[model samples]
Target: MNLENLRREYLKGGLHRDQLADDPIVQFERWMTQIIATNIPDPNAMTVATVDADGQPSQRIVLLKGLDQRGFVFYTNLRSRKAQDLKHNPRISLHFPWHCLERQVKVCGIAEPLSAAESLKYFVSRPRESQLAAWASQQSRPISSRSMLLQQFEAMKNKFGKGEIPLPDFWGGYRVKPQRIEFWQGGVHRLHDRFQYTRQADDSWSIERLEP
Candidate 1:
């Protein structure tokens, strides 16, 4: 497979330092708004990377549940691999790949569990079916077969039987408090534009442009 010529020129646009918002969170929201306006599928989908106790790393795609000054938030089974990893090591990274816009946002931070009240608030907003499924699946665990999984789902459906499903004890959300964030915009001739925002000791952000 001689596939050395698989590439496309990024002529969409170029990013200027002046165009960036003073606050990275504000800039992230602006970019997110543009992405949502377009037809791009799952605009909030992001790659979350975590490391195990042994220092081995793992990555997975998760939907962004909430975002604010506190930081980015996502929910998952508290007993999942990612959750276990976070328990051992809070350090984590997140990457948003907005390929259609030729833009990317990389975030590095520590993962902290959201309050039970906060988790329950989002849990109740989920669809009934999703709520039931959340109880049935033991994420990151091996399953016997598809039939067995569906059986568990069916069992949960019957148990709930039109009643509001409660939040699973082993399920909740995590907030990533970002220490650093980098925004990248693809440019022609492989000269990309990159700007990084680092959190200062006084909670202020120090922005710097990095060479591509």
Candidate 2:
């Protein structure tokens, strides 16, 4: 397995300090807007990492449902593995792997559950089937097979019966209040550009460049 031959040069453009916004959220939205315009699939998808109480780390891809100065928001079943980990330890990390643009963003933050009102608002906006699926899936829990899961979904459909699917008691969203965020852009010769924004006590961001 001598697989060292799988590397490619990142010839994309470089990021400069002058181009960065004072607010990381603004910078993030700028990048997000660009990526969305490119029609790339699931540009809002991000990798969320959390550690259990026993110190075991886990990672999974989740959609970025909402974003603003408050933080990045995502929804899931409260019983899910990631949700359980967040319960044990609210500290969390998120990564946006926009490799097509040779850029990425990393965030370290504290995870806080979104209010029930907020969760319900977002939940109702979802497609009916997705809303039903949320009710059917136990998320991190085990299932016997696809047929059983489908049966559960079918049961939910029949129970709801063209009526509005209520938000499940165990389903909700979490917002990651970022304490530190880093934006990285690939450069020629591997001299990548990296800038980090750390939140100050005054609630302002302090930006600095780091070695590639």
Candidate 3:
């Protein structure tokens, strides 16, 4: 199969500077709302990129659990590779690929661990099976077999039978305080429209257009 032949032109509507909100967060929220309205699969899914102490970069898809003025939030096991990387270096990047809309958003920021109380609040809201799975699995660690994993899951289910499953001490969330955000809208002939918001000293944002 010739992979180079796979190509499609994007002709989605262009993004204008006048359409941008003064705050990047607000603009992001608007885009998210549109995506959600379209019934897109896993609209909250985002690619999180982190760098290790050795300068090796790793990326994975993580659900955007919460978003507000603070920034983007996602959860994972504290001992996971990504978590460990963030522990050593808080700098991280996030990418939201809204391909159906021919748009994407990129965020660069510092990741900070969410408070225990905040993590607990979201944990309890998750489905019971997911809660149990969280307790059973050691994320990013090698396991023996499928049966062993199921056995652990069953054991956790029984342990928390007929009661609330407490949040795992090792499982929690991180908030990425974005220092820069870029919104891209694909245009005809591959000439995309790109606008970037850079954080200012007064916590405001300065918007700039980038040549595509």
Cα shift from native, residue 128, model 1 (Å): 0.3
Candidate 2 yields a Cα-based lDDT of: 0.96
lDDT of 2 by residue, 1-212 (tens): 97898878888788999999999999999999998988999999999999998999999999999999999999999999999999989999999999899999999999999999999999999999999999999998888899999999999999999887999999999999999999999988889999999999989999999999
TM-score of each: 0.98, 0.98, 0.98
Model 3 segments more than 4 A misplaced:
none
Name the 10 consecutive residues with the lowest summed lDDT in model 1: 160-169
By lDDT, rank the candidates, best first: 2, 3, 1
lDDT of 3 by residue, 26-100 (tens): 999999999999998899999999999999999999999999999999999999999999999999999999999
Model 1: which residue pairs collide?
none
The C-alpha stretches of model 1 lying farther than 4 A from their native spots are none
What is the RMSD, in Å, between candidate 2 and the native fold over all Cα?
0.8
